[model samples]
Target: MTETVTLTVRGMSCGHCVRAVTEAIRAEDPAAEVAVDLAAGTVRAATALPRARVAALVAEEGYAVQD
Candidate 1:
């Protein structure tokens, strides 16, 4: 089953950041739907991956992701 992961992310202040995070998550799940709210510093994704794994993917992109 697919699950939506909503995480509080920090240090994403531009379009580049958004793309980077989105790409990172999508890399893990090609069909994942990713939405980044720069103003709110949050990322929401529709994916089958576990929440911790999703957070780790964002972290791998050098962004701070809250658990």
Candidate 2:
């Protein structure tokens, strides 16, 4: 079953940040669906990967993921 993970990411100020975050998540699950809310600083992703893994990928992009 697919799981949906929503993470609060810090330091995302523009569209580039969104793309970066999306790419980071896709790095782990290429078929995952990622949605970015710049104003809310949240990244909602649908994937089978563990939440911890998703958070780690977001952090890899120099973004803080609020668990």
Candidate 3:
């Protein structure tokens, strides 16, 4: 089953950052539905990927994912 998660991200300063995060999540889960709110520095995704994997992906992109 797909699960939805909202992660509070740090260091997302611009549109590029938002795109990077969105791409990172999609790369981890091709079927994931991702939405990033740049102003809020948050990402909401509906994915089958595990939470730890998601967090790692964000971290790899130099962003911190806050629970």
Candidate 4:
């Protein structure tokens, strides 16, 4: 079953930051659907990807995932 996760992200100062986060998540799970809200600095994804894995992907892109 697909799971949904909402992650609060830090260091997203612009649209580029949103795009980067979106890309990073998609890179890890090609079939995952990702929606990044730049204003809210949150990313919501529908997939089976684990939270820890997602956090790692964001960290790899030099961003922090707020718990």
Candidate 5:
């Protein structure tokens, strides 16, 4: 089953940041659904991958994921 996780991310200021985060998640799971709320600094993704892995991928994109 797929799981939906919402992550609090910091330092996302524009469309580029949104795309970067979305790409980072999609890179891990091509079929994953990614939603970015730049104003709220949150990223919601529906994926089968574990949260830890998702967090890592987002971090790899140079953004800080709130714990």
Candidate 6:
């Protein structure tokens, strides 16, 4: 089943960061819907992947995903 995973991500300061996060998640699930709010420092993604996996993907892009 698919789920929406919302993460509080830090270190996203520009479009590149947003794109990195969005692409990172999309690379995992091409159909995943990703929205990044740089101003709010948050990422909201609709994906089938587990929350931990999503967070890990974000972290891999050099961002901090808060619990």
Best by TM-score: 6
Model 2 bad stretches (over 4 Å): none
Candidate 5 local lDDT, 1-67, one digit each (tens): 6999999999999999989989988887999999999999999999998999989988998999999
Q: Model 4: residues >4 Å from true position, as ranges?
A: none
Clash number for each model: 0, 0, 0, 0, 0, 0
Which residue pairs of candidate 4 clash? none
If the candidates were sorted by their TM-score against the true structure, best first, what order would they fall in? 6, 5, 1, 2, 3, 4
Q: Compared to the true structure, candidate 6 yields what TM-score?
A: 0.96
Candidate 6 on 1-67: residue-level lDDT in tens? 7899999988999999989999999998999999999999999998999999999999999999898
Model 3, C-alpha of 25: deviation from truth (Å)? 1.2
TM-score of each: 0.94, 0.93, 0.88, 0.85, 0.95, 0.96
Report lDDT (Cα) of residue 21, candidate 2.
89
Please tell me which predicted candidate would have the highest lDDT against the true structure. 6
Candidate 1 — which pairs collide?
none
> What is the alpha-carbon lDDT of model 2 when measured against the actual structure?
0.91
| Per-residue lDDT value at 11 in model 3 | 91
C-alpha lDDT of all candidate models, in order: 0.92, 0.91, 0.86, 0.83, 0.92, 0.94
Q: What is the C-alpha RMSD of each candidate to the true structure, in Å?
A: 0.8, 0.8, 1.1, 1.2, 0.7, 0.6
Model 6 spans with C-alpha error above 4 angstroms: none
**Model 4 RMSD, rounded to 1 decimal:** 1.2
lDDT of 1 by residue, 1-67 (tens): 7899999998899999999999988888999999999999999999999999999988998889876
Q: At residue 41, what lDDT does model 6 achieve?
A: 90
